[model samples]
Target: MRTAAYVLVRHELRLLASLAMWLARRTHGAGGGRVFGYARGQGAMMFGFAFVCLVETLTMSVLLRDYPTVHQMVFVLDVYTIVFVVGVHAACVVRPHVLDPDVLRIRRAVHVDLRLPVDRIAAVRRELRTTHEHADGELDIPVGAQTTVTVELAEPVAHFGFFGRRRDIHLVRFHADDADSLVQALGQALAGAVTQARSAPSPRPDLPA
Candidate 1:
């Protein structure tokens, strides 16, 4: 029964996502922007969960509509509002990561925006597995991505998590369809940023008397 329900929820979310994508394309035209990475399966699962929550909210609202007590209606409304907010958050999470010239921006499903600087990226490498021994401070955008890119940072970056939790992360891991291509892009961007920094003239020093 649980598996059947899960499948139904996924189906609904996929339908909703398809409609939303179609509307977006019609409004904005094709080729929205260059997206570096996507949550893929992880995103689908989250959207499915969101769809289930939304359906439950609607059902509760309908059931409580005829209730005499005003508090009951208010409570139903509040639950619906919370579910709507969570659904919006899930939609945001399903959006792909936007790659800019100098920064990589990930709009997480949980309402967190992670912006990583290209210059601060120390190294870009591909790992066979997700787990690591020295992964004390690591950030994985979509957890459980098979083709993963491990980005080592030159300096520790403070990342804010859900519920006011903040931690310093030295590594950023994410799954990409084409891990090799992503690595190449990062390498080129890092090299360009480094070269630009080096070519810029330094401030002149004043002679001491």
Candidate 2:
């Protein structure tokens, strides 16, 4: 009996892990999977751009004798320089979002078993809106096959509705997300776990992302 019980426990853990892995992959979506590829493409384009800019600048410098228009050249160079800087900055921010070491990586990952325990639950921060006296936020709510929820928070307002304004309350805030199904499932599971932790006897530990 003891040997059989041990074997069963190992098998169950393996099954659960497999399910969790599946869910993680499913939730990541095709865009997430191609993050690395996107980053590589962007890097290549930037390199090519830099090479062309260098050649153009050098050629223009040599041709200064023929078209000695200093002001126009300065203006063109200034605009091009700004564009290059902005492009590089954008690439840096997007690189992490598509790479493995992304800062916004999931905090916890677990199997789809709703009965699983929850230790720490952090609110998803979709879009953060701030004001002098109060702060508001919005969550990406997928309405259906092609709908979405966009909420705006207002301070000192009784509720965070569409008409909420910046003034009136000392402070106010709201939040939302686009991952409706996963978030809803996670919420229900966490709520149940919280209830169980209070009444039932069990050890609920935090899961790794």
Candidate 3:
């Protein structure tokens, strides 16, 4: 119960922070690293859902006028529901996938944040996959029911779920607004990392007197 409450409170705070970031027209923790956003595909759908919620709110306000207590309670819930719907999208907008030189940060809203070391990435390509099986070592983060970029790791990386469940991920598939660009950038970053590793000079053996 304590863990559940903590998770709930943390989610609410994250939503509020996301809304603030959205209003401020800034992203979260995307400095120096290249940001790849996956929020574009769901914007229209989320707004449409919010519009439907608004309609329901107005309809309820008229229908429940006689019951003062009931109307007040319903009204509060309606407004909060609308905000929650919009806040989910805002979270996605603010927290995008970040690709740094050393780590590839993959995130989905407030739930999933998996950082894979660049050296562990074996291959990355632009592959649109709509169907995914429930696998033990694969993690799929799809936007609008489709994944655009696929990443295969040389070694498994540890991912902890929202409820503190650990999973070893050897394959990662996710969506990005500009899939090609993200794939290209990540490939280049991986290549650069490899080249730097190879080109690094080894320390000379100590010469004995």
Candidate 4:
């Protein structure tokens, strides 16, 4: 019970923070990094769903007008539902995938956020996959009904779930609005990371680029 409450509180906090970021037209962590957005595919769907909720709220407000106590309670719940739905979309908008010089950060709303070291990435490609199969060591973060990018890592990376569950992932598939550009940028970053790793002396570490 306590764990569930904590997760709920954490999720609400993330949504509120996301709402602020969305209102400010700012991304969460894209400073000094390339931002790749996956939210475009789901933007229409999310708003459409919110519209449906708005309609239902209106309908319920009229039907429950006879019972003052129940009407007030239902009205509050309906408004909260609308806020929650919109906040989820806002979270997706603000928390985009980020690619630094040495790490590639992939995210989906307030849930998945996995950072893979550039050196550990074996291959990255622009493969549009609408269907995915769940397998051990594979993590798929699909946007809408499809994924536009596929990444295979040379080694496994740890991924933590919303409930604090942990798993080791060797393959990751996700969506990006401009997948070709993301793939190209990742290829260049990987090459640079590899070159730097090879030239660095074992006893002395190279400075952060």
Candidate 5:
């Protein structure tokens, strides 16, 4: 059930690729992958929340139309709005605790076919840990051992860490258990992609020849 929540959140995030891609292009000059990832994650979460809000609003509107008097309808709508907002807020706040485990499942689903470039593909491991202050938090991943990859979520934010920076403080964490196999698979996939990209000539000059 918790894993399912993470999958749902990630699915919601994937739906925002168009906007994320657009922003990535604009900020390509900023050299902040972490920033971009954070933005994308937050945007995705907001989009999901907004969708829920719209549905709730519509439902309330329909239900209120059947009320006999304006005072009764207004009182009912106000109460409903308050309850709905509070529930949404609480749900969003608690969502991470349920979804963290699903990250591993998502990691395994990536295409390992021969045609895809390995450089463009990366594998992820998610760790879920309980904290005193919060039930669930995120851990940051360093890209290629040098760059920071941001891990943010919809309701509760996770912890972020880079190699050698505050390493001791981690209580709850997720990682690729079979890291060697994952790296090998990703490397092979990348190598295959590189070969294909190189063999196929392209008009663009900036890309690797």
Candidate 6:
């Protein structure tokens, strides 16, 4: 009876662990088993800015309490609400880049969702320069980034930008805290993808043809 009880407890523990993992994945928006990479410095900066905004808002609220006219009250409320919204947006900016087996997904706070296929990548290189001068057909997503990784595509991709403007992009540049490591990992994944495609057998042709 003790042995049977032990096994039952083990099974319940596994079920509970699985439930917790599922909930975590759902909360993180990692539904497809994608790995995440973060811009640590940029995230820190955003959080710091949010904290400053919070302090300023509180100070303003206290200062404006004496002049409680309808107009002044409305202005104060608007300022507080705007700052609160900005802080929330800043918090969301910490969302990491999702790296899938065959794609790199970048999601910005209600601004852009970029999905780049692994097979289409021609090269992944690190740019050490502090400021990058973008070429005419390049799509750049710097987002207050410090380190940079430039991804060259084999062919031009149609990227829809803000305001629904579509443009053909031959290269993409983005920032990451560990740009070198990211480039190395991405290169290895792309190489493996290429090898797999080459090793895949082609469809059989018709005998009569």
lDDT value, candidate 5, whole model = 0.34
Q: Per-residue CA lDDT of candidate 1, range 1-209, in tens?
A: 24657655664464456346544642111134346544454556656676776677667667777774954766667665555544443454345565667886655443456778888889989765655444568877644435377788998888876534688998877766567777777788888999999999998999898
Name the regions of candidate 4 deviating beyond 4 angstroms: 201-209
> lDDT: which candidate is best?
3
Instruction: At residue 203, give the lDDT of candidate 2.
Output: 73
- Sort all candidates by lDDT, best to worst: 3, 4, 6, 1, 2, 5
Report every candidate's CA lDDT: 0.63, 0.36, 0.92, 0.91, 0.34, 0.65
lDDT of 4 by residue, 1-209 (tens): 34978998999889988988899998898879999988888989988988998998899889999998998999899888888888988999899999999899999999888999998999999999999998999998998989999999999999988888889999999999999999999999998988898998888688899
| Superposed model 6: Cα runs more than 4 Å off | 1-27, 70-94, 145-147
Worst 10 residues of 6 by lDDT: 85-94
Per residue, candidate 5 scores C-alpha lDDT tens digits across 48-147 of: 6656766766676667767648546665675555444334333222221111111211111111001111242333233232222333333322211222
- lDDT tens string, model 2, 1-209? 24657655654454444345444443222243212111232345556666777767776667674666884676488456645533442433232211121111221111111111134333322333332232333222111111121222222223222222222322212222233443454445455656767997667788998
* Clash pairs (backbone) in predicted model 4: none
Superposition error at 5 for model 5 (Å): 33
Superposed Cα deviation of residue 164, candidate 4 (Å): 0.7
Evaluated against the true structure, the overall lDDT of model 1 is: 0.63
Model number with the top TM-score? 3
Measured against the true structure, the TM-scores of the candidates, in listed sequence, are 0.60, 0.27, 0.95, 0.93, 0.22, 0.70
TM-score quality measure for candidate 5 = 0.22
Score candidate 3 by lDDT: 0.92
Name the runs in model 5 displaced over 4 angstroms: 1-36, 68-209
